[model samples]
Target: MRPIYRNLAGLIAFLGVWEAAVRLGLINDQYVPPASVVLTRTVELLGQEDFLRDVIASMLAWAIAMLAAIGIAVPAGLLLGSLPGLRTATTAIVEFLRPIPSVALIPLAILVIGGGPESKIALAIYASVWPILYNTIYAFTEIDPLLIDTARSCGAKRGRVLASVALPHAAPFVFTGIRMSAAVALILVVSTEFIAGASTGIGRFILDATSGGGRMDLVLAGTIVAGLLGYLVNDGLERLGGRLFRWHAATTTEAV
Candidate 1:
């Protein structure tokens, strides 16, 4: 069977088991609604303006954070990766900051940026920057030194060499990094919204649905929507990546 069919089959089987477990009284239906109920609610939520708004708000924040991370990380990565001295100089600070959890900084973010979009964006940016920056640095390492030397020998300036040589060679790794950061950005967006209790977002919607409402179905439905959104984003980026870098795709297939 095709991979898509296998994935569908797995999903069906898992939902069936979940439904069975709830119906059989093996699990508390009040706490964990049946798959059918959650699926139905998820479908119903499609028509709800409030739910859609929350989704859009979350996506907007996610997009903003991801773009900001890319903007900052790419340039910084290029600079640091191109210059071994700068990379070495910043290694200690990068190591220190990279390991700090974004979630742990929520209180500080809230204090600094306040309890809304600004704080959420701050957290998401923090969470998403590292992967892209590191990947870009790694991409620079994989570049052929001979190619760079050849470009310089041809009287190409540093800026010209970077724009014409380094970036093209690094494009694949850079895209890979962006793709990875996309997922992380989404996760952080939702998490920040949920934790920071932002006025608008899917995370806030989920939080509201679960708090003292006994709305297990709505909660599960929101969760399903979030998961589906993440899947779609990742799949879309993957397809875009494959299309944008045919050489990378060919190289990967050959390796496989």
Candidate 2:
């Protein structure tokens, strides 16, 4: 039993059980459509012209928001994390806002940003920044003090030490933060779209299918697509991080 084959077999068994339960009336199709129906509607959606447009819009919003979060968070986090006094001064404020749910800001965002694409992007960025910033701070604080002392003894300037020592050591933690940001960004993207009453994107598609009368199959199909997209994004980020930080991966593998 190969690992991949075992995974496939497990998936097939789960789907078969789900389909049987739906067919046997133990589960209601109106609320939770069978996997077969969802797959059929998913295929139909792939053929729709509007589907690509929705996907592109969602992807565009996600990319822009993520880029903005990284751009702002990394530099700002580095600056604050390097300055102990500044970090101490700002800890109270950061802690206060970090606990506030991003979804709770949607109403204020709608009022100010007017339920547009900009609002969605803004919310995504807001939700993503905390993870990136916090991880970066942790990365900086967790550096080996002995390593810094050794660098200083070897006559490395502050800039050289930071560029060669600090950044390299922190890279893994920073990438970990970005991975978390990606997941958070996806949630905010769909959530803002659904709540803002937008006319396009996967969230809107789900809303329309669910609310526009008997289209449980379509709703389930949209959900499946969303889940697949999230999975692919997370996997892609993990692969990229693994490649960029091969040393980290090697150390973890050796430890395991």
lDDT of each: 0.90, 0.89
TM-score of 1: 0.94
lDDT of 1 by residue, 159-254 (tens): 999999999988888888888888888888888888888999999998999785769899889988999999999899888988889887776654
TM-score of each: 0.94, 0.94
Clash statistics: count for each candidate:
0, 0
Q: Relative to the unseen true structure, what is the C-alpha lDDT of residue 229 in candidate 1, on a scale of 0 to 100?
A: 91
Number of clashing residue pairs, candidate 2: 0
- Name the TM-score of candidate 2: 0.94
lDDT of 2 by residue, 1-256 (tens): 6997998899899989999999999999788888898899898898898987887788789999999999999998898889899999999999999999999999999999987899899999999999999999998998999989999899999999998899998899899999999989988888888889776788888888778996999888888888888889998999899889989877664421
Residue 200 miss distance in model 1 (angstroms) = 1.0
